[model samples]
Target: MTLIVDQSTINIQVLFMVNKETKKALIEKGAEIIYLKGFNNTGINEILEAASVPKGSFYYYFKNKEDFGIQLIDHFLVRFLSGADRRLSVTKSSYIERLRVFFDDFLEFFKGNGFKGGCPIANFSLEMSDLNENIRKRLDTAFDQMNNKIALFLEGAVKNGELPEDLDTGLVSNFILNSWEGALLRIKLTRDVYPMKLFYNFVFQDLLNFN
Candidate 1:
């Protein structure tokens, strides 16, 4: 009888793989902490304790809190952009209907959070823009990219004859994004969703109904 052992299989088994779940926990916990405590006020030990991740692991993944913050901003953009792209993409619903649905859903999300944390990008802008140039630059780029996404959809609406051909898509998109961010701040202050609901009503009811 001859017995053969596969050395490659053993080596592969011994190789350590990064724990994706642990890394994700760190990011998610860190984000929540930042929401509760402003970024500058948030301590590294708080995040580590909340995530149950070791200090070495955090340093291995991030150079420092600033690096981690950049990543968090990136994470927020990815999630927000994906939802925006869906609502603004071509669909059977009219452009106005799509806009209504989008804002309504956003209002519902804010309500779910009890109007505690406002937009993450907006929060970062208020907190870190003056203090950290790198973060401020990243935030500026992110806001510009988000504005572009809105402009792209508005352009599509113009092509589909849903909006006026001469309408300034760029300016309109900028106004809409800025208005929403302001509304979010008011919602946090009042602990009410009426401000957001009012924004939706104004935008879709009066602003977009130029026919």
Candidate 2:
């Protein structure tokens, strides 16, 4: 098969791909640093340096740091929801087991990291919500997106008798997210797994009450 290649089309394709790769690189590098440091403590130049990107071209990809932060939240939301969907969708598993698998993944992650770098969204919320409205709003929506996903799963569990029929999925999911984020904060502060384990225990045994 003879391939007819247009030079202009090829150039556009290459440029678009490069742009996407560069943007993803920046977000990934930035997320790495911001996870350890914070939104206020982290600088764009630092992210650029980590990404091995030139100084001037950041504006080419993002309008500003706020733009970058918003993009980061958006990127995180997509990745998080994807993982949640996977962890919460095992066909043969009980709904409770599916949720336990989800938390266990994070439990292992924080333990491996020595209990540092808690939830990225919670970190951003603590640092940026009072400071930047755009970023705050983006973070707000991200939390809601997360809650909605968990609630959707919980709603299914309620319908299937895995949870009580009277259970409020929305409220329960909101509480679970809040408590889990708080647990992450505690573990990060104390550098201990006790709080994380505590959350896992109470959530499953007391609140959800699943056998």
Candidate 3:
């Protein structure tokens, strides 16, 4: 006996994969809007409209708006950390030079974005830190991971004699991240790149100078 499978069943399976892709696209679009507009200011309809995704699709993928926000935070951090890791891993540059290049690259990126949205982690922390515990935890984890990466690079700099042997890598890492976040906020407020330039000059030229 021969058995036949229904074509409709195969189509349903394909549709399932398509749905998953669509859901992820919506989440990414939501992340973009969140960066441009704060969590409280963004509405579901607005996200759906910007994403060009149906309301049913959003509901199918996420449990609610808050769940979408959580996923968005995770998504941004993954991209952010990956980019930083790649930039920091460049072999041709010293650790100090790598750090300067990374800062310059981001300064250009913020300027390209018109200085409208600050750092995503900083944006969420300012808006959701007190309001949402889950998001707060997510931001905390992002900070720890990014700070650790910076410290690891700083330690390498010390070993390479690019930085002082007695330099406190961990402390310097925290200060750098904190200062960058603060500079981003000021840049967004002033709609000027001066704050970023100041930060780069101070951190790279003054604070981290070993020569």
Candidate 4:
């Protein structure tokens, strides 16, 4: 099996690698600025500067700020879910325990950040939903994906006998996500974890009926 690769193919592969790194850098830096300043408040120049990309090449990488915003949402989801996947999948315990730890992990993440930059998805949802339909729809998909992930965790709990088979995981996951974002919003203003702590307690204790 002689797998002979061509020079043009090799060049294309190298270009893809370069472009991928550049794009990821833009999204990462853009996320940091947008998370703090907000989508409207953030400027493309600022993002390019933070990313160390040339000022004139923003269009080469993205159609415009709105396009960048969509990719930024994707990068945020991937980074967040990668961490969550580790916490949920790598452990040797029931999904119920893993799910609880997943929440706790994010709780600690917020506490460590001093409650700054509330949920990026929620922030973008509020800022862009009415202003741009395209961005709003992208944010909607991101939120749905999050809900689906939680629903999967709940389904796992049921399979493990930690939750009732008849439990409505879809409804429960949506509620849990809503409650979490609401708590995050409150925590951002309060600069305290009390709201999140309360949210956690109500979900795991009263709602989930965990002892």
Best by TM-score: 2
Q: What TM-score does prediction 2 earn?
A: 0.95
What is the alpha-carbon lDDT for the whole of candidate 4?
0.87
Q: Candidate 2, residues 103-203: lDDT per residue as tens digits?
A: 88888888999999988988899999999999988898899999998887788788778998878889999999999999999998899988878888898
Residues 1-211, model 3: lDDT tens digits: 8899899999999999998888888888788888888898999888898888876667878898888888888888887777778877898989988877777777888899999888887889999999989889988988998898888779989999899999999999999999999999999889998888889889988998887
User: Which ten-residue region of model 2 has the weakest summed lDDT?
Assistant: 87-96
lDDT of 1 by residue, 12-62 (tens): 655433466676788899988897688999988889899998876788778
Model 2, runs deviating above 4 Å: 1-3
Tens digits of lDDT, candidate 4, 28-93: 888988998998998999988999999898899899888998988898888667766786685488
Candidate 4 error regions (>4 Å): 1-9
With a 3 Å backbone cut-off (N, CA, C), the pairs that clash in candidate 1 are none
Best by lDDT: 2
Q: Output the better candidate (3/4) by TM-score.
A: 4
Q: How many residue pairs clash in each candidate?
A: 0, 0, 0, 0
Give the least accurate 10-residue stretch of model 1, judged by summed lDDT: 12-21
lDDT of all predictions, in order shown?
0.84, 0.89, 0.86, 0.87
lDDT of 2 at 33: 94
